[model samples]
Target: MNKLIDGFLRFKKNVFPQKRALFRDLAGAQSPTALFITCADSRVVPDLITQSQPGDLFICRTVGNQIPPHGSAPEGGVASSIEYAVHALGVQHVIVCGHSDCGAMNAVLHPERLKDLPSTNAWLKNAAAARSVVLENYVGLVDDVLLHLLAEENIVAQIENLKTHPAVAARLARGELQLHGWFYHIHSGDITTYDAQAGRFAPLDHGSATATPPRRIYHFSAGDAA
Candidate 1:
């Protein structure tokens, strides 16, 4: 922990002074541009990868970058954060980022390894659909390739789960929100974004927007109210 403390001291003495005005403006309130949801892996630093300032991105991290579908657990941390970011904070973008060589993904691929981690295994059920997609569809692939496919599919799964949130669904209906799925290569420091048109993850281009396909809006029919 000394390293963290020393880093904080350096920030306070040097970086803090440099960005004093920015912090001052953000002291009373914050208006971040996006809601970044990613794996809780140390290597996937959201701000560092995005090069965003303190008040730029509101982040939520979870193992495997999983997002439980809405109503599965309404009071859950991820659900609450999504609601606050969209309804309260008015963030326009919600990103689900997964990384290469993710330990959580590896665990998903090998469930036997998680027998001691009951809670973790339970939580990873959120990615079960992704696991099924990868295993059933991508046959004959090597272990490493399968792991990578699981990570990518998990990101896509989480994005679909994000839409189930009431806040996200409502905003999406109005064409006000955009969803993005990202894969970050830990070793190479490369990022690829899901391209709806291409139906694949493509290299991220600076100054360009990479968004998920249009979401299906839920219509509440009057007859169903009976």
Candidate 2:
């Protein structure tokens, strides 16, 4: 508590003042270009990872970067946030990012270890598909390697889930928005983007890549609607 308080005090005394003009400009209005969704883990800082400043990215953080499919359950915060980002803010891109060593993925990978976290256990039910993908595809890998693979697979899974939202689907259909799946390697400072054509996540800088354009994800588009 004291450490958090000290951090806040330091922000107030040093950081906030230095960025006051930027904050003041952002105070009136914001027109962020992307809706970045990721885990609620302390180590994953969306802005820091993207090198973005305030007003550049609208963000939503969940336990496992899970976005429930549309119409599957009662409308929730994640749904509302996605709707607002697309329809209201007119964000061009929606990025679902997952990272290595994610506790949520760990819970799914080892449900037996989550005996005490009932709420978390319930929340992670959304990631069942992701768990199955990892188990079915990469059965033998364990520890960091297993977790890393699961993290990448989870991002791809969530991107599919994001398409289930009505507004997102409609926008995508009309070529008004784009969706992206990214896996961030926390330990190596590496980032991988899902290649729809190759059906895999490849290093962002992989030259001579045959991956589909980042704009044409899952047959969705970002141009004027028909």
Residue-wise C-alpha lDDT for candidate 1, range 123-223, written one tens digit per residue:
99998999999999999999999999999989988888988899998998877788988999999999999875676888888644556544656667999
lDDT of 2 at 143: 73
- Which runs in model 2 stand beyond 4 Å of their true positions? 205-226
Q: Each candidate's lDDT (Cα)? A: 0.91, 0.83
C-alpha RMSD in Å of predicted model 1 compared with the true structure: 3.6
TM-score of 2: 0.86
TM-score, per-candidate, Cα-based: 0.92, 0.86
- 1-226: candidate 2 lDDT, tens digit per residue: 9999999999999999999999999998999999999999999999998899999999999999988887766338999999999989999889888888898998888999889998788878888887888788886675778777778778877888888888887777767787778888888988888877788888876352322233333653666455
Given candidate 1, what's the lDDT at residue 132? Answer: 100
Say which candidate scores most in lDDT: 1
Candidate 1 positional error at 7, Å: 1.1
